[model samples]
Target: MNPETLLLMGLGAVVIIAAARWIGARTGLPAAALLAVAGIVYAVLPGPNISLDPHIVLTFVLPPLLYSAALESSLLAIRANLRIVIGLSVLLVFATALLVGAGFGLFVAGATFAAGVAVGAAVAPPDPVAALAVGRKVGLPPRLVTIIQGEGLLNDATALTILNVAVAAAVSGHFSLPKAAGLFVLAAAGGTAVGVGVAYLVRLLRPLARDPLLANAISLATPFVAYYIGEQLHVSGVLAVVVAGLIVGHDTPRSGTGASRLQTNAVWRLVDFLLEGIVFLLIGQQLPAVMRGLAKYQTSTVVIAVAVTVGVTLLLRPVWLSLTQAAHLLLRREDEGLNAREIAALSWAGTRGVISLAAVFTLPLTTGAGEPFPDRDLLLFCTFVVVLVTLVGQGLTFAPLVRRLGLRANEVDEARQRNEARMASVHAALERLDDLEEDEPGDAPTIEALRGRMQERLRRYEHRLDVLQSAESDEVPVSEHYESALRIQRLAIEAQREELLRWRDAGNLPDEGLRRLERELDHEERVLPDRRE
Candidate 1:
């Protein structure tokens, strides 16, 4: 395609993405699924369509997306659910691959066990983007959200490693259990090390990245650095990127200033929004490419291949979660474990996405001896089928499933906990003011003024907490006075912003000065909770 065509396609994709996002917000559907449908519609219309390049997706697209997710995820929550995360991310992926491999090897004609396993590996990891977006919107409980996030963050590494090992075995016509296990171990360890090293390197450079622009520059580069270094070292680049993101995210609050944090967050949000939307569209557009190689295979053969993959990929998750949950219940003395509803919800959330397509696209056309890779085209179709089925089918229905199961989060309790935390922070501030009052000479008026403001904030929190605790239902009780106060504060901020704009328009204030003052108002407005009265 020419540059003009590419540019037009890019712009077209943005338009579709924006439309999908708007529709999703209104209809409570996943934008990812919507974008996929739109792409498919466009693909079938006899126009130029984009084919997914695995190298481009893996190297350029995957890192930043993973990094952004890792940054937003709670490291502590993931650690708490580490066992379940491991079960889903690693053990489940391996088991699914083995099961699918066995199915294809025994049931599907002319398919090798290694090639079957390669397809299994491709479809193993669930992409958390769609699920997380819908889950948070529907107020899924924090524990469930953490599990999904943890699994998504870590599972790519496992699936990609298995895919690589399976591909190598298929290419060389050699398969050894011990060697495969050894390779997986080496990749995991090396990737983890590289990720940790990159995170520490970032920490050492935090002082230099204190400026918002510089911080964004470093943040943008961190994932690629981790991925590139890991790939160069013959380790798992996916794991490296994820690990670096998690560690850097965990340390971000302690290391960066408020402005840096704000700017970095805004940048990553835009990156994630654009990248995720384009990726889903890209996935749908590849239907033409995926279908092109299936002419040689018998109709029945293609149907059976698609069924084996779709069946194994969809059914294996719930069964695996049930078995793992049972095993945990049997072994543990603790009263805590996933109940039936939680398990059901988690099972339904296993929607595959771009990583599956990217991994499969990386499959080579020929083996080491120059023979065609067994069932290469068939495998691609199966992977694409699996992605389409899960991403669109499950993505669309997951929220409804959660609702049917009566699994919505307790928002009132969550608000109460947050208010309590705010109360404690205010107490700490008051204590600090006391110390400063004793130490500082001739700052009595300023300190006293600060103390009054802190006291007022503490009172507001206490009142909110009291109202929350006294609530009779799960819904948060909205105080009219509180809502009115917030609205007034918002209006005040808006008026100040208007004045700043007016000054800039009249040339009384420079653009830079106006921007600086407007930023202050933005932050102030951001601090207020949205009650949407």
Candidate 2:
């Protein structure tokens, strides 16, 4: 592409992305899907077609996107659900590939077992970006979100490994189960080791930088380095990027200065936004091409493939979730566990996306005899159909399902926890303030004022907790009077927030002051009953 064409494409992408977001917000569809459709429409036009090289996309775009997703994910949450993550990431991918591939080989005409497995592996992993974006909008339970993200992050490696093996076997006209299994283990272990090692080195070098921006730049380059190193060593690049992201994200605070932390976060956020936009837009652009490919396949074949893929993707999730939950119960007798609501949320949230598309596009174009690969276009078309059906169909219905199931954040439980923590912190602060007041009598007025503010905040917390607890017990009936009081409190908090914003705009308030006040407003808003519900 020429520079002028590239410039136009960049500008068009931005415009399309913005419009997609606006439309999605109004219609409850994912902005990614909308952006993708726009890309497809643009591609079908007569002028200057944009063709993306699979190698450039897999090497350049994917590493950063995966790293960003991994960085934003909470390590603690992943650790908590380690078993579930492992099961979904490794075991589920293998099972899905085996079953789907076997079915295709046995049933579909002109499809070999190797090609079938390759396609299955390509479509096995759900897209983390799509799932999380839609899941948050639908208010999926935090635990479910964690599991989905965890699986999404790790499954890419498994799928990619399987894909490589399948393609190699197809090209070489040979297969070795033991060799493939060994390669999988080696790639995973090697990738993880390299990633963690690179992360530690980055941490060590971070403190040597005087400028925060420079430190942030080092953090940005680490993922690319990890990925390249892993690929050079014949390891799993996906796993390498993911592990590196997690290590740096979790350990950055210890190695980074305050300025470094802020700069790093800002850089990652910008990178995340741009890459996410590009991925979704590419999805839209590929749609026309996919449809054209499907033209060669018989209508009945296309229908059968679409029906089977969508059905398996949707139904497999709920079955896996139920089985996982049962296993968790057997293994651990903990009081806290994922309830049915969470499992339901997980079942509905399995939306396939970019990874599947990228994998399909990366398939080899020729078989062992140097003849053209069979059903290559058909495989890509079927994969796209799976993504569209799951993303648009499930993404749209997710929120309504949540409401029907009465699945929302348990505010009463949250408030009780917050109150307990706040009460303890207040008591500790009060003791410290008492000693300080005695030591500095001249500053007693300031201390007393601070003490009074803290006391008032404590009282508000207690009042909110009491209301929630009482409401939970059904001792206090819903009252118009309480509702009115909540409305008034909301208005007051809104006014206070505006005042804080004004101070921020005028440079009269520090960042900390604005953040603290905003947090207070958020807490108050959360406790306020949802009138809409």
Candidate 3:
């Protein structure tokens, strides 16, 4: 594409994304699904359409998306749900690939087992982005959200590893189960080692990255660095990026100044928003291109293939979740099993995204012996169709289903926990100040002032806790005293900001000096809730 066309396409994608968001907000539908449908609509009528470059998607796109999600993810939460994550991300992927492959060989004429497995692997992992966007908006339970996040983060590695092996078998006409298994173990272990190494290396160099700009720069590059290291080592690069992100995110509080965290988060949110919109739009735009090659296959064969792929992708998830929950009970595990409704939600959340399309699109045009790869275009079409069906179908319904099932998280209980914790922390600070007063009698007045403020905050937090515990609904009542304090604080900050502006306007302060002071005040003002609202 030329510069002008590329610019136009970029602009068009943003417009579509904005429209999707607006529509989704009003309709309670997923923005991703809307963007994709918009792309498909544009694909049929378009003067210009963007084709997905598999290498670009995998290298340029996948790393940052995975890394951003991982960074937002809680390491403790992921660890707590590690078993469910592994089962869904690893074991379930393997089973889906093998089962789909076997079904194709048995049922679909001219479809080889290896080729079917490759397609199966491509579509196995649910893209966490769409599900996550909707789940968070709809207030999914914390544990279920964690499971989805952990599975999405790790499943790409499993699916891609299997896809690579399946493709190699198809190309070379050689297959060894044991060798493939060993290769998988090596890839996983090596990728994990690389990810951990990269995380520690970043920590060791934290002193050099103390400058907020420098720290954010290093943070942005860490995922790509981890990806490259894993690729060079012939390991799972996706896994490497995710692991590095998780570790880095876990260390973020202690890794840099408060300024770096604020800046880094803002940057990542923008990146994620743009990339996700562009990606799903790209997925939808591929439909016309994929279908162009479908002319060579029989209609009946194509339909059968699509049916098998989509059906298994949708059905296998719920069944697997139900069976696993049952097994948890049978084995007497510590986890309280998921009820039917939770299983239903998890099942619906298995919507696929761009990763599946990217993997299938990466299929080589020809095998090692110079013959064409069997059903390459067909596989691509099926992959695209599967993404469309689930992304739109499940994405559109997931929110309302959550509401219908009444599976939203208990916000009242959560608020009470937070306020209780805050009360405890404030009490601890008061206790420490009492110790300080004994050692530093010269600062007794300052200590007393601090103690008074701490006591006041403790009282406010206690009042909030009482409101939360007694509230029957999600809304927690704020104390009038707390509201008044917040208003006074805001008023004082505004007065200080206006005085600074007066100094700048009167030529008493330089622009740079004014900006520095403004930033400090801006950060402080952001620390409280608005009382007027």
Best by lDDT: 1
C-alpha lDDT of all candidate models, in order: 0.91, 0.78, 0.89
Q: TM-score for each prediction?
A: 0.98, 0.80, 0.94
Candidate 3 per-residue lDDT over residues 353-382, each given as its tens digit: 999999999999999889999999989988
lDDT at residue 69 of model 3 (Cα atoms): 93
RMSD of each: 1.3, 5.6, 2.3
Counted clashes in each candidate structure: 0, 4, 0
Q: Give the Cα error of residue 77 in candidate 3, in Å.
A: 1.5
Q: Write the per-residue lDDT of candidate 1 for residues 1-533, one digit (tens) a residue.
A: 99999999998889899999999999999999999988889889987888899999999999999999999989998988888999899999998888899899988998888889999999999998999899998889999999999999999998888898899989877666577778889999999999999999999999977899999999999999999999999998889998999999999989979989999999999999999999999999999889998999999999998999999988999999999889887898463679999999999999999999999999998987888888889999999999999899999999999989989888799999989999999999999989988999578799999999999999998998989999898778889989999989999999999988899999999999998888889999987986721
Assess candidate 2 and give its lDDT. 0.78
Better of 1 and 2 by lDDT: 1
Q: What lDDT is reached at residue 357 by model 3? A: 94
lDDT of 2 by residue, 1-533 (tens): 78988999889788877787788889887777676667767778877755545677778888888888888888889999888788889987877776667767777777777777778888888886766777777666677788888998899899989888988876776656677678899999999998888887877886564478788778778778989999999999889999989887787657767656766777888887777878777776786667766767888777766665666667777888788788879989563566788788777777787778888888877876888777888888888888777766776677777778876655456556666787789989989999999999999999999999999867865765666667744223345655787789889999999999999999999989899889778866875755322
